[model samples]
Target chain A: MPEFTLWDIVRNLLLAARWTVALSFIAFLGGTVFGLLLLLMRLSGRRVLERLVGIYVQLFQGTPLLMQLFLLYFGLAVMGVNTSAWLAACVALTLYASAYLTEIWRGAVAAIPRGQWEASASLALSFGQQFRHIILPQALRIAVAPTVGFLVQVVKGTALASVIGFVELTKAGGMIANVTYEPMLTYACVAAMYFVLCFPISLYARALERKLA
Target chain B: MPLQLDFMSILVQWPLLLRGAAWTIALTAIATLLGGMLGIVCAWARAGGPRALRWLVGGYVEIIRNTPFIVQLFFIFFGLPELGIRLSPMTASILAMTVNLGAYATEILRAGIEATPRGQIEAAESLALTKAQVFTRVVLPPALKKVWPALVSQIVIVMLGSAVCGQISTEELSYATNLIQSRNFRAFETYIVGTLSYLGLAILVRNLLYWAGPRFLFGR
Candidate 1:
């Protein structure tokens, strides 16, 4: 019966933006840690480990995040493992981000010339030492730009967590619109918030890419 | 009691699942055709059109690229009606998908277009070719070929993204899965089936595009 102000919508959305930012950070950081491990496994020179990780990456990348979210949220509940939307979203998105990150880092690692490996080996550097000192340093430089660019994707991807009822920016917009009868304004605010979050990263990524090139 | 998995219960709704997948493909097909054309036009604008047009196209690419597709879809579906422009869910879904793909493809194709050798265009011009002839005969084909793999990947992404269109009740595969789950209370099984179907679809679509892009699009 009461009217909702523009400030009210923007204010509420700003509050919800924190969750979006938090979720993205959690997913990105968690994915990066796990993805680095996957990268190590892939580069371990063991054919079986490499193929296992390849299937893992494919399984995550080949399916929709929405399906992954649904599977986790509902699957967990069905298994009588009480889970909240937040927990489920975190798990699903972390896995999703890890898959892409692993592939990206692998490409960067692969870009390192094979000579780097042989040179390190000839110098009596152990496998871990070569990877730690020789390979990863060079690969990290190549990896930075694309990895930053991929953050935009992870941010955009967090929007899907709203499907499972995680009350991030997108879900908050829907809720506000439903309550205020102002779908246009609410969603515009939501989109604007996303833009504000994403555009600068996009620009920075491009700048880093050009700088790297 | 231990958890038990059931697949046959959801698999029985094969017809509904098929219909939903048909709609997803139909929506994607329409969007891909329209969106690919839109991308080319916008790419041309960004690459070679007038300065003002380039700015306009650039603005569009940045805006669409920065937002999530679901928000874009929601805006088109729910927000437009307030402006007295009502769209069916299917119409809005296709429109959203096309716009999303167009923005992404514009950037992708512009990269290809910009990489076109200046000498090639100059050579075509000296040979008395018109601007249109130069673009069509010498530029677009190779530009597309150079970026075909990226384009195909983007198309597959849009296809998988269409699953969200079901959020608006558009009767896509995810929508059918939701329906079957609600009916049978087999939520996990229904979504599992739906996910596998989407995985299969993504693989199939990617292969088809890769196989077809060279033969049909840019030519040998």
Candidate 2:
């Protein structure tokens, strides 16, 4: 057995946190792409497309993320796809993040005045051109703060992935606690590391929101 | 070779699954009640508390909201014994959930409280009611009634978040599923059963929250 000191625990946690950061970026970035697609699908003129996307958001939003991770982990392996805990965790989180992001961006886009869209259309702009030139830039401004706010959520959510056996910060904390037999100290350090990672983001989100307001 | 999935083996552990589900519900309910009360106090602090108190509440909410629930759970459960306070996994899980949920509840309730008009407080004052009376009888009800929707949503989030308590060996739904999987090697079916059970619990809590909304709150 290895002797664990405060520095030892923090050092190990920092290393594990790299995975948390990597996974958060993967989920957030990948989810943003899917979210954008879902947003367009939701805004499309076709009823069935819109309805399908609407239900997708509801299914992910209404269910627990932990459950989503389990379903993806087990579901993928059951379907005969090669499944590792990491891949399942990433895919499930991306899907979950996408569902929520789609709704958030959709709301942001809808809040843009209708007259602006009509103006862009009258300028003989194609739908893509109109959205690109006129709408998204403005909507992105309003979206920035909330998007960042949602990022804080994404970071918090990554902790849940530990349940799937990914050795991220929370899991590593657990591992260290088991070895050091200092559950409380090991875990408190874990919580502090998370605070260090997330608290600034929360404050920044609030500042952005205030500026936007 | 094709994957050999076994539902029968998983179903053979149905009693175990039910026990897990029962523990999850029990944890969720206990955490919510305690958390909800803590939230009300924090919320009240934010609304009318002293400047120092407001800063304390603000800091608490920001810290909790920013961090992950798993880390918070570990802090309270695995982290507390270092301070010489030992608690069972069940006790630790509920306490963690309550603390985590309270921060969120405070944020939600603070929003509700802030939205209450200053005019209403003045009206209560003109009636010469004591501050406690004004808060209980006049102000808090309307504030909470207006924000019940957001508050209920937070409660649901807390309910789902309780699943993390499995990490500490509380043998809640997820822990039980993990046990069954390792024991019987029925990974897919066992996990599927677990996910469905969680989804069911989430829905049931939402329904219960909705039903209790008008009865204990706003009906006076």
Candidate 3:
């Protein structure tokens, strides 16, 4: 049996934590872009587009993310498209995050009084112009805190990627525990690392909410 | 070859799937009851207990909130044996879920509790109601009512999260799907069924909570 000092386990977990961070960043960024598009579609006043986006959001939000990852990982491969765990994890997390982000931003946009839309329209502003100049500016302010708060969820969600063989902090801890027979110490470190990464964001989100309120 | 999906290969194992779904519901039900109680206690601690107890509950909530549920499951299942507290997969899954849900519930309930009007508590006290009666009669019902929706959403979230317990070999819905897939090599199809089942369960649980909340918990 390989003897792993506490430092060894901590170091390896920290190294793997980088992937957790990276995956979270990718998922959050991609989710934001896709979520923005869906938000626009929902707000476009086309009933078809609105309903379509609504189903998309509901489908993603309604399911467990682990199943989504499995479907992507195995589903893609079975379809003859070679899919790495990395690709599957990224895509799944991106879609999952997108669903929640769209909902969050939509709520923020919905909070805008109807008069703002009417006022902008009476100014002869196009929908795009109205969204860009008047609606988005106000909505973005409301959306910021929640969006940041969702990043913590993204970080935690990355832990699920480990099941599909992506070696993030959680997976790394499992491997170390297997080899070093230190599940207790190893997983404690894993939990600590996640807490360290997520707690600050959670606290900051609350602070932002207070400040904004 | 063109894409092919034979969900029948998985559906033929309906008994396994049914059992898995039952386990998932049972685990969630037990955890919800236990965790909801834990949340109420912790919320009281945070809202009105001693300062030291408040700090302790605060720490518990923060630690549980920040970590992933999977890691928490792993820790409880694998780590606790070191402390001479060995738990079976089912037990550990329940414990982790209960702990996880309790933390979030505490926060949600505390919000409701804090929002209780000052005059209401004062009025209850002047009526000579004991502290316990005041809390149960004057504060809790309205607080639960105010936060019922949020609590329902959290319960749904926790139910969806129990999917991770399958990784620990808990024989939940996802575990059954994994077994079916491994048996027939119908991974994708099996997962689709499992995922849809989860979505169905989430919707079902949410509606159930919403119905039960007003009917049995806080009055409409």
Candidate 4:
């Protein structure tokens, strides 16, 4: 067996950490766009749209994300649509992040006082206009801190993509552990990398919450 | 070719599914009990203990919260053996989950405890109650009532997270699903059943906690 040093494990894991970063970026971006769409649908004042979005949120939130990853990765293959772990992890994480983002953004929107809506509507603004001009701006401000906080969750969540064989940080750590026979050292390095990635965002989120409050 | 979904092939293994679900619930139950107690102690320490102890507990909370649960599980299961502490997969999973939940609960419960009005504590102190009595009787119940919803959500998250324990072959619900799928090659169907079962369990557990919190933990 090739001798592996601590530096070898850390360096390789750092390289693999890029994929974790990339996946989180994609999932957060996709989740934001998709979650916004779902949020609008829920706020659309149509009963069917509202209920549909509610069930969608409940369905995603109520299940294990591991199951979602499995369903997307394996389910797509069974459907004869060629599937890669990258595609499955991206899609699954996007959907998972969307469900959560929608809820967070929804709460932010709901926090807007009823008077804002009433005054906007009294101006004869259309529902779309009211949301676009009056509601969205205020809601976005309230949503920013929680949204940033959720990014930490997204980053940590990419660790799960390892199980689907996407070979990001955790997967690379597993590979290195096997080679070095240093499961303890390797996994410790893995956790440290995640902490380095996530802790700053978590602190920033806390700061934002304090500022907003 | 048209898609034909056959869930029966997976459902036919109901016994395995039931056992898997049972294990999942059992693991969650044990973790919740142990972790809740750990959380209370740590919260008390952080809220009212000495400066050094508070700093120590704060460090523990930050480390656990910032990392992913899978990595934590791997460390306990795979890493600890290097220190001459070999644990079975089940024991490792339970310990990991308890530790994970304890950290989050400390934060959640501390929020409630800190929100306690100074006047109430003073009143209890005037009655000549001990510190422990003050916390348990005059402070804790209301604090718990205040944060019950957030605590319920965290518990549900931890329950769903226990799915990761299967990665180390803990034979939880996901493991059972994996086993059945490997046997029948019904990966998609088995996962659907497994995912929905988790959804059912999440909802059930949430409701159960919401009910039990008032009736048992803090009173109606």
Q: Judged by DockQ cut-offs, is candidate 2 incorrect, acceptable, medium or high?
A: medium
lDDT of 4 by residue, A29-114 (tens): 99999999999999988999999999999999999898999999998898898999999999999999999999999999999999
lDDT of 1 at A212: 92
Return whichever of 1 and 2 wins on TM-score.
1
Please report the candidate that would top DockQ against the real structure.
Answer: 3
lDDT at B135, model 2: 83
Every model's DockQ, to 2 decimals?
Answer: 0.84, 0.62, 0.90, 0.89
Q: Is candidate 2 or 3 superior in lDDT?
A: 3
Put down candidate 3 lDDT per residue, B94-154, tens digits, no spaces: 9999999999999999999999999999999999999999998999999999999999999
True contacts kept of each: 0.85, 0.73, 0.90, 0.88
DockQ of 1: 0.84
TM-scores of chain B alone in all candidate structures, in the order given: 0.98, 0.94, 0.99, 0.99
lDDT of 3 at A55: 89
lDDT sort, best first: 4, 3, 1, 2
lDDT of 4 by residue, B8-115 (tens): 899899999999999999999999999999999999999999999999999999999999999999999999999999999999999999999999999999999999
Model 1: per-residue Cα lDDT over B81-125, one tens digit each: 999999999999999999999999999999999999999999999
Interface RMSD of each: 0.9, 2.0, 0.7, 0.7
What's the CA RMSD of model 2 in angstroms?
A: 2.4
Clashing pairs in 3: none
The reply for model 3, stretches above 4 Å from the true place, is: none
CA lDDT of each candidate? 0.94, 0.86, 0.95, 0.95
lDDT per residue for candidate 3 within A1-213, as digits (tens), equals 566688998889999999999999999999999999999999999999999999898888888899999999998899788899999999999999999999999999999999999999999999999999999999999999999999999999999999999999999999999999889999999999999999999999999999998
- Model 2 residue B135 CA deviation in Å: 1.1
* Cα lDDT over the full model 1: 0.94
